[model samples]
Target: MEYILLIILGFFAGTIGSLVGLGGGIIIVPALLFLSAGSSLFTGINPQVAVGTSLIVIIFTGLSSTLTYMKKKMTDYKSGLIFFIGSGPGSIIGAYVNKEFNLASFSLWFGIFMIFVSIVLFLKDKIKPLNQSSSGIARTYTDEKGQVHTYSFQPVIGILIAFAVGFFGGLFGIGGGSLMVPAMIIFFVFPPHVAVATSMLIIFLSSITSSVTHIIFGNINWLYALALIPGAWYGGKAGALLNMRLESKTVVNLLRLVLILVGARLIYQGLL
Candidate 1:
């Protein structure tokens, strides 16, 4: 039953993570923390350990989601690669920094961050895009529906943003997807689908580095992480497909809802 629950949790995490490029870490991390607090099976689980497990799980989530997005031709490989380059070192730094903070304090801060982010996502549609008068690096891509999207942003700004996102992703084990999607949309003017697809690729790369760091630090519980893989894999594929069918606003709203639930729960736990 415990294994089954883990798989189910992974499935939900993978499905939602792929759809929004939030990488399911938001779901996985909190669920693991909750399990630790509530279940004998997860006794001794700490936020850092939960974060570590979340990063490992994200590896599987990113793999399944990226493949599905590739088939749909939704991924912006060139831009995604650039994001990965900046995110790599940042992830390692974040993993190292995670060890410096008190787990309870860190968890509380993370919860607050998520709440703030949730508000941003909720109001994302109301935010205006960057001024187009200043032209950026011109780019174009086509989605699964044969719609071509042309947009631009300063590459340096995007790289810096990716670096920060990766740092927090590593530190919090949220895969940076939750933050990346919003940044790409609001700052870079990336189309929602494009952001989602590209975000998965970035998360995939960054999470690998973070996970490796966690392994060296002995933060991961392999038994728990392994239990989530099967569900995460299959769920990722399903979520990507669902993403192609959903409206962009719908996707944003879904992310907002998830963030609020998870963030609030974490805050409550941290206070206890």
Candidate 2:
């Protein structure tokens, strides 16, 4: 029954992850919290175990989704690689910090970040593109088609953002998709679809690096982690397909609502 529940949760999380490029952590964390409340199977180190396990499952999820995006030529590898370079070191540092620090700080930061994500989604339309604007920070990148893509900041700035996001990924056991997607959209002016695809690609590399760090640090629980894989795989595939049918705004709004609810729940849990 526990395995069944994990699979189902993984399926749902993967589907949502693929659709929104969240890499499954946002959904997985909340589900685990809810499941732990009722199930005796999840106790002691299970929460930490679950996090490590989710990261492992995300490795596969990221790869599969990234491949699909690559097939469609929606992934921007150059930028993704650059982001990965910085994120790798950041993830290692974050993992070490998580091992040493109390998780309450992480929970608080996670809540704040979620709130910020909600606000960004709420103000999606009001934000204008930074093209020829001199005041706002913007950067331009040319694609294979010679299309000059202008964003709110330069690539160097993006590296810094990726480092911060990667650190969060290590601390929270997420693949950094939640933060990356929004960053790409708001700061880089990437279209929603493009951002979603690119975010998955970025998550893939970050998760791989972070998972390795966790493994080296001996923080992962294999049996529990294994339980979540099957569901995440199927769910992730479904989510990638769903991206084609749903509107980006709809997905973003849905995720924002989920984040808000999760953030509130985390705060409540912390206070308790």
Candidate 3:
């Protein structure tokens, strides 16, 4: 029964994470903490363990979704690799710092992160991209529906933001998609499909880097991880398929709603 619960949890987390580029930690970490607090077989998870376990699970989630996105030609592999320049080391550093969090504090801080994402989405159109006049790094993409998008970002700023996003992702075990995806769409003017697809690529790589540090800290719960991976794997695939079927604006609107709800839950949990 405990394992069944974990499988179900993993499936939902993966689906939600992959569907909206959240990377699933937003669901998994909190659920683990919630489950641990209950009188059940899943118990005794500290924040560090939860974060570490979530990071590893995100790897499979990212991989499964990414592979599906690849077949559809949706992922921006080159851009993902470029952004990793900063996110990789930042993730390592964040993982090392994860030891500092307690359960309540982690929820409080992560809730703030969620709010930040919501705010960004709300103001995305109002805020202009950095150095809008400067075509620092530009690219063009045409989506499955033959919609063309040409976007650009200042290279240095892009890398730095990625590092910050990676740090937060590593700190919270969320794969940084919450911040990265919005930044891509708003600042870089990336197409929604491209942003979601590329963000998963970065998530997969950053998770690997962060997970190694967690492994060294002995923060992973191997049993829970083993139970979660298979479900997360398949859910990721399911989510990617669903995402492709939806319109870009619809995806963003849906993501916005989910972020707000998730953020509220974390904030409420933290206060209690």
Q: Candidate 3: global Cα-lDDT?
A: 0.90
Q: What does candidate 3's lDDT look like per residue over 113-194, in tens digits?
A: 8987988898988987764646587778888768788887777788999999899889999999998999899888888888
Every model's TM-score: 0.94, 0.86, 0.97
Q: Encode model 2's per-residue lDDT on 1-272: one tens digit a residue.
A: 78888778888888878888889887776567557666788754444554566678888778778877777677777778877877777876776666654445545666677778778877867886433346645445454455776555455677888998888887677788888888788766776767787788888888888888788877676766677788888777778878866776777776787778877776666555
* Residue 59 error, candidate 1, Å: 0.6
Model 1 whole-model lDDT (C-alpha atoms): 0.86
Off by over 4 Å in 3: 131-135
Predicted structure with the largest TM-score when compared to the true one: 3
**How accurate locally is residue 181 in candidate 3, as Cα lDDT from 0 to 100?**
93
Estimate, for each residue in 167-266, the C-alpha lDDT of model 1 and write its tens digit. Answer: 9999999889989998888877788888999999999999999999999999998998899999999988999999999987888888788888888877
Judging by lDDT, tell me the better candidate of 1 and 2. 1
lDDT (0 to 1) per candidate: 0.86, 0.74, 0.90
Clash pairs for candidate 2: 15-235, 137-152, 138-152
Ranking of predictions according to lDDT: 3, 1, 2
Model 1 has how many clashing residue pairs? 0
